[model samples]
Target: MDKIKLSKEEYENAVDEIRKFFECERDEDIGNLQGQIMMDFILEKIGPSIYNKAIDDMQKYMTEKIDDMYGYMIP
Candidate 1:
């Protein structure tokens, strides 16, 4: 996939969220710059696997729902 780019505002927002999550999950408050770095690392190392798993799950869910529809009958 092409390199994913976020606007500055969006990137800042993501960093803010990362800070909040670090605080919540680890009881540690991290600075915005640290958050940004962490987010970049995560996106590079883990994001594609997570994204692919979500897509696979969505496809499985849709396939099951479509099969259910096919099994339905008019009353």
Candidate 2:
């Protein structure tokens, strides 16, 4: 798959969240550049697995819904 790209707003929001997490949990102040680097690292290393898992979950949900839909068909 091509690299996942977030919109500017999303990217900024995620970076801000990362900065807040470090500040609150680790007592460290991380700048935007650092947060962006960390976000990129996570996307490279962890995003694919998470994306696949979500796809699998949605597939299962849709399959179950489709199975239920068959029950509503007329004889």
Candidate 3:
């Protein structure tokens, strides 16, 4: 599987959200660099499991839909 890469805008947006979360939840203000590092850590460590789960979810949904297709055929 290819490494997930976020666009520049998306990366910045994620960093901003991270900063906001820390400020709101922890009352600790983090800089942009800190937020980027945190986001990168999250992606490196946690992203794959999330990605795999999404793939699994899609596969299950498609399988169900495909199975239902059998009902559409004229007997």
Candidate 3 to truth, TM: 0.94
The lDDT, on a scale of 0 to 1, for candidate 3 is 0.94
Cα RMSD for candidates in order: 3.0, 0.7, 0.9
Cα lDDT of model 3 by residue, 1-75, tens digit: 666789999999999999999999999999999999999998888888999999999999999999899879889
Q: What TM-score, computed on C-alpha atoms, does each candidate reach?
A: 0.70, 0.95, 0.94
Better of 1 and 3 by TM-score: 3
Instruction: Give one digit per residue, the lDDT tens place, for model 1 in 13-71.
Output: 88999999989999998997899899898778887788889999999999999989988
Winner by lDDT:
3
Candidate 2 lowest-lDDT run of ten: 1-10
Query: lDDT tens string, model 2, 11-71?
Result: 8899899999999999999999999999998888888888999999999999999999999
Ranking by TM-score: 2, 3, 1
